[model samples]
Each structure stands twice: as structure tokens, then as C-alpha cells.
Target: MYSAFKIGKKFLHYYFTAANGKGHGVHSPFVFDLITKVLNDTTNHPAYTEVEEQRRLLLQNETVLTVEDFGAGSTKGLTKQRVVKQIAATSLKPKKYAQLLFRLVNYFQPKQILELGTSLGITTAYLAKANTNAVVTTMEGSAAIAAVAQEQFDALQLKNVNADTGNFDETLPELISKPESAFDFVFIDGNHRKEPTLRYFEQLLAKAINDTVFVFDDIHWSAEMEEAWEELKQHPQVTLTIDLFFIGLVFLRKEQKEREHFVIRF
Candidate 1:
């Protein structure tokens, strides 16, 4: 993980260089629509408050659990024991980006959704709520964390989610081989290292359709992650790429004969 000062510097550079959130001079009709309809949508969604309320409650909880570090460890340093508040603080996606994900699902209405990480299920709830008809399969590495996420799902009454537990390496291949593995939308947030990140992307590629969209979290987290992001962009199947600083979105739309990449401010 990069130091706070380094992350701050990168953010400053990104902020100044990326295109504004507004459609402005962006010429691609599809991207323009995304900027106007999804990225810039201003409606105050109810899920914002609902999921945020769960985040608020978790922030105050002092319950501790034994954890297993499977991926790139936490920024605060890894430990076997951790408090719920500490996990929530370190792991949960910020409400802003989580709500953006909600809006994306709400807009695209992907029938089959796959989320590689379900840290406390805050983001999972947002995804499941966006399209009630969609089936969300969310995976978590730790059993204790997965249990807490299930509790959150029950609290939200999100019946569409199917939580899977275990290391992604052991769990993902089986999930991908299933008959219904043709995922319409995938959110990759589990392991942050380059090899695991690329491995998951390549494995998931087998089930990807032209319309399938893949979102990678912490694209600029480190040098290796940035390398993975660049290699993904250069792949022949990736027709379009969107860089939102913290997260990167990949598109494999067949209609786009020419590839394009955009760094958009969010």
C-alpha cells in the first residue's frame, strides 16, 4: 500500500488531469450517456441512507473477530484479531463510490452480478438493492467476516445475494465453471496484488460476453496494480476503459470497433 502522502499526491495529479464528470467535450455517445445518466445522476437514492445506516452502526460496534489475511494485508498492518469497527473503517467502501455502484446497477440492470469481495456486505446490499431481480454472488475470504455480511444481508432483507466463502483462488474457478457463470457485471475487489488480480481477470474472461462489464477497485493502489490496469487496457478484447482514479471500469462491447480509454473525474 502507498503511504498517505503518496496517495494524496497521486489524487492531486489525477484531479487536475482527468476530464470533468460532466459530458462536456466527451464525444463518444455511449460514454457521454454514462457521464450524463449514471456518473452525473443527482437523484438522492433511498439505498444511500439505508446502506449508510448499516455502515454507521458498524462503525460503533466493538465486537472482535479472528481473521485470516489472504490478500494484500490491511494498511494499518495485519493481525489475527481485529474489532468490527476497525474492519468497517478499513474495509467498507466509502458511501460515495458504493452509491455510484448502486447507480450503475440501477442503470444497467445486469441480471447476473458477481462481486469478488463482500466486506461487511455494505456494497453487496447496494448492488442487490439496485436490481431486485438480479442475483448477486458475493465472495468473502474470512468465515467470520462472511457471517457478519450475511447478518447485514438479512437485516436488509436482500434475498437475491448468494454469499460464498473461502480464498478466491479455491472458490472462483468452481463458480466460473457453473452453468450460470456467464456474469453480466463483475466487481473485482478481493486480492489487490498484480498476479492474483490478473489471474482472476483472466479466469473470469472465460465467462465474459461482449456486453459484460468489469470494475476493478484500487486500480492505482500500487505500482503492480497500476501495471495490471495498463495491461488490461491493452488487451484486444477490452474495447473501452474508464479511469475514475480510485476505480477502473473495463468494457468489452463488440460494437466498439476502435478501442478507447478515458480518465474521467468523479
Candidate 2:
């Protein structure tokens, strides 16, 4: 409890400082261009409209469904009374994140994409649209939510998306054991708990390609999450890590010699 408070305070301080253009002051050329082109570049695109439309659809669904939460539930939403609208609103992947995911996926054009959480398929939709040739496998814990997401995917004609509904503890292991399991992009948005996050990272590390990019959401969510992100950044395989307050991105590039970690404003 106390640690969460401290993290929240520090996050607020960072937020104010970042907004003033004081952050990312003459960082790596690569990261500087990324910040200017991706983060600071607030140019709205047609895809953003698509994400907003999906958000509207999700928000309009007043239907309530039981949520099978595998991770810590931060909301007052009990496992019983989980409204679709509430979940849409309370979820971590806000509009900004959806936009970022869309832009990143489009830019990276990763052949294989893996998403840890498939909440209403908002992020999944963005990824699917970004790379039509890419095969997207999204895992969702709640059967009801997963069903709804699958329906949304079909309705949108997003043929690349495959929604898997099950307890990730078993599903992830089985997927990792598969013979052809190489992922160029991985989004770690599920199971926000510290130990589980680290465990998942270690387990999936084998599947990453040389140019793999991993994005972990809510690094400043709590002290434990921050610690987990920091430890992940220090991993031998991780050559670069970018801390954008809301998300921490990891890049495993063999060409980069020195380990680099940057905290840039987005």
C-alpha cells in the first residue's frame, strides 16, 4: 500500500515534468526520432477513427458477463457483476494506447504478434488492421468476454485474429512448447502481478526473434510492476528499453553493443 502511494507520487511528478518538453532531452538518435515521430507526433490517422468506433461499440454494450480474472482485479467489479461497459471504461488500454499500438504495429510490420490480454478486442483490432499478413494470437481469461471479442473480430472481417479463451497458466506453456513458436511482437498486458509478469517474460523469452519487440503495459502501475520492468530491462537478452511512463518497451537487437534504457515522454 505504501509502495503504491510512492509510485503514484513519482508518476505524477514524472507526468508534470514530461509534459513540459523537459523529458527526452537529446537522447539516443534512434529514440529521439521515435519520440518525435511516434510519441510526440500527435497526428491523428484514419485508424484512430476505427479504434474510436470500436470503443464506442464496446461502451454501448450494457450487457453484463461474469469475468474469470486470473490476475488482480483493481476495480470494485466483483467477479459476478462485470458489466461490459464498465470493463470497457476501466481497462488499461485507453484510446491513447490503442493509437500507439496501431501505429507501432503498422510501423514494425511484425509477422507474428502475441497479445496477452484480449479485452473486448480493441487492441487486437488495431493490431489486426496494422498488419494483415501477420497472424495475431490473443489470450483472454474470461470465456464470455472472449466470445464477445471473437464475434467482434468476425464482424469486422479481421481474418488474422485468433482469440483463445482459457486460463493463460496452461495455455501459455502449451504455446511456448510448440515447435514453430517465434514471435516478432509481444504485448504483455495481462496478469499485472509482479511474479507472474516475470515468469511469463522468462517463459516467452525463448520465442523472441532477434529483432523482437516487447511492450509491457502499466510499468508505473505499482512498485512491484516497476521492479519487474526494471529487472526485465536488465535481462541479458534485452539490448534496449524505453520507459514511456505508461508502457515500457524492450528491444532485443544483436547489433546494439551497449545496453541502453531511456525514459521518454509520450
Candidate 3:
């Protein structure tokens, strides 16, 4: 993960170099539509309020649980026990990015969605709520954290979600091997290291279609993660990629005439 100073510097560079957020000069019709429609959508859907309300509750909870680190450990030194409120504050995705994800899912309406991390299930709730008909399968490494996420899902009555608790290496393969596990939308957030992130992408490729969309969180978290993002952009199967500083979105659309990459301000 990047230090505060490094992250600030990168964000400033990204803000200046990235394309306009209003789709002003974008040439690709698909990307233009995304910027104009999905990325910029400001509709205050009821689901947003409901999920945020849950987040408010989580912020107040002070229960502590033993967290198992499977990916790049937090910049804050590793500790066995962490408070629920702290996890909700430090781990959960911010409202802006989480809402952007909701807009993407709401627009694309992918039938099968897979999420690698389920921290407090706030982001998972946003994804699941975006499309009530889609099947969402989210994996969590910590049993304690998974239990909390499960409670959130149950409280929200998000019936389409399946919170699978276990190591992603063991659980992911089993889920992908199933005959009905072809995912059209995937969010990789659990692992932050380069090798594991790349490995997960490779494994998930087998289940992806031409229209499949994959979103990677914390793309610029570290030098290795940036390297992983770059390598993924150059992949033969990836037709397009969009860098939004915090997250990177990959598309495998066969209709693209040429592979392209875009850095768009968000």
C-alpha cells in the first residue's frame, strides 16, 4: 500500500492527466456512454440510502474480532484483534466509489456477479442492490468478518447474495468449477499483492464472456499493484481498460476494433 504522501502525489498527477469526467473528448462510443451515463449518474436511488443507513450502524458498533490477513497486510502494523467500527471506517469502500460501482452494475445488469472481498458487506450490499435479479457470490477470508457481513445481508434481505467464508485460494476454485458459475461481472478486492491478483484474473478468465467486465480495487495501492494493472491492460483477451485512480476496470468485449486504455477522472 502507498503511504499518505505517495497516494496524495499520485492522486494529484492522476487528476491532471486523466480525461475529462464529462465525456467531453472521449472518442470511444462505449466509454463515452459510460462516462456520460453510468459514471456521472447522480440519481439518489432508495437502495443507496438503505445501504448507507446500514453503514451508519456499522460505524457505531464497537465489537472486536480476530482478523486473518490473507492479502497485503494493512499499512498499520498487523494486529490480531480489530474493532468493528475501525474496520468499517478503514476497510470499507468510500461512498463515492461504492456508488460508482452501484451505477455500473445498475447500467450493465450483469446476470452473474462475483466479489472477492466482503468487508462488512457494505459494498456487497451496493452491488447486490443494483440488480435484484442478478446472482451475487462474495468470498471472505475471515470467518468472523464473514459472519458480520452475512448478518448485514440478512438484515437487508438481499436474497441474491451468497457470502462464502474461507480462503479465496480454496473457495474460489471450487466455486469456479461449478457448471453454473460463469460470471459476467467480477470485483477483485481481497488480494492486493501482484501475483495473487494476476493469478485470480487468469483463473477467472475461463469463466468470462466477451462482454464480461472486471473491476480491480486499489490499483495504485503500491508499485506492484500498478505493475499488475499494467500487465492486465496488455493481456491479449482484454479489449479495453479504464483507470479511475482508485480502481481499474477491464473489459473483454470482442467488438472492439483495437485494444485501448483510458485514464478518466472520477
Candidate 4:
């Protein structure tokens, strides 16, 4: 992964060059609507309050667990033993971006959602609450952390979440072979390396439909991740893509007509 200084410099360049978040000067009607509606929507839905409260509880919990390294390891260090609070602070996505995910699920209402990573179920909770009807299948690498996440999900009564524990490289293929093979929305957040990321994308691609939405996390975290993002953008099946600095959203919608890519400010 890139150092803080390097990441900061990249963010500065993106902030200056990305299109305005207010949908200004963007020509694509679908993208313009996403910018004005889902990306910029400020409505304080009740689900935000619920998930945030769970985040606060996680931040305060100090229970320690031995975590297994499955992908690009944490910047906080590769220590095996870590407290719940520490993982919550470093691993969980910020409320802003997380709320944006909730909005996306709420707006699109994808029937089947696949989450590549489930840290402590904070983001999973958001995805589950966004649409109770939608089933959220979340995968976690660490058994200890997965237990904590499952406990939180049970406590919050998020019945739609189906937590699976294992390394994604081993489990992802087996998952796609099941009856619930096709996914409407897939959030790739587990591994950050180029090879694993690309492998996951290819495996998931078999089950993806034209309307399927794929979101990749930490696209700019490292050189390899950025390379993976660029390759994904250039793929023939990818019709549209939006770069939000922190996360990258991909659209395979056939109705888009022409392939377009936008670096939009968020």
C-alpha cells in the first residue's frame, strides 16, 4: 500500500481534477442523475442512525481477538492479536462513504447483494437495513472477527445478512456454484492486491447480468489496485464507471449505449 504522504498527494490531484459533485458539466444523463440523486442525496434516513449507533458501540468495545491475515494487510500493522476497538477504528469504512452505500442499495434495491468483506458487520448492517427484502451475503476471513460481526447482526436483528467465514479465494468460487449464483450487486472489499482483486472480478463476472452493479473499494490504495481499476474500466463489458477517490463504482448497464468514465468529486 502507498504511504500516507503518497496517498495524500494522489487525493489532492483527484480532488482538483474530478468533476463537480453537483452534476455540473456532466453530459451523460444516467451519470448526471446519479450525481444529483444517489451520490448527493442528503436525506437523513432512519437507517443511518441505527448503523451509526452500532459503530459507536464497536468503537467502545475493547475485546481482543486473534485475526488471520487474508489479503493486503492492515496499515495499522500485521499483528495477530488486536482489540475490537482497534479493528473498528482502522478497518470499518467511515460513516460518510458507508451512508453512501446505504443510499445506493436503498435506491437500486438489488435483490441479491454480495459483500466481499465483512469487518465487524457495520457496513453489512447498513446494506441489510437499506433493503430488508434483499439478502446480503457477507464474507469474512477471520473466524474470531466473524463471530463478533455475527453477534452484532443478531443483536441488531438484521436477519437478511448471511455471514460466511473463510478466505475469499477459496470460498468465492464455491459460492458462485450455488443456486444463488447470480448477483444483482457485488461489493468487492476483501482483498486489495491486483491479482486477487482481478481474480475475484473474473469469478464474479460469470454470474453478473447486464444490470449488475459492481463496486470496488480502495481503488487508489496502491499501484496494483489502481492498475486493477484501470483494467476494469477498459473491459468490454463495462459500459460506465465513476471514480469517487475513496471507492470506484462500475455499471454494466446495456442501456448506457456508449462506454464512458467519469472522475466525479464526492
* Model 3 per-residue lDDT tens digits across residues 1-266: 78999999999999999999999989999999999999989899999999999999999999999887676865432438989999999999999999998999999999999999998999999999999999999999888898999889999999999889888889999998998889999999998999989999999999999888999999999999999999999999999999999999999999999999999999
Candidate with top lDDT is 3
Encode model 4's per-residue lDDT on 93-126: one tens digit a residue.
9999999899999888999999999999998998
The Cα RMSD in angstroms, rounded to one decimal, for candidate 3 relative to the true structure is 1.8
For each candidate, C-alpha RMSD in Å? 1.9, 2.9, 1.8, 2.0
* Clashes within 3 Å, all models in order: 0, 0, 0, 0
Point out where model 4 deviates above 4 Å.
Answer: 74-79
TM-score of 2: 0.90
Residue 243 in model 4: lDDT: 97
> Judged by lDDT relative to the true structure, which candidate is superior, 2 or 4?
4
Per-model C-alpha lDDT, please? 0.91, 0.81, 0.93, 0.91
Measured against the true structure, the TM-scores of the candidates, in listed sequence, are 0.97, 0.90, 0.97, 0.97
Ranking by TM-score: 3, 1, 4, 2
**lDDT (0-100) at residue 234 of candidate 3?**
93
Residue 130, candidate 1: alpha-carbon lDDT: 96
lDDT of 3 at 151: 85
Please list the residue runs of candidate 2 whose C-alpha ends up more than 4 Å from where it truly belongs after superposition: 1-8, 16-24, 73-79
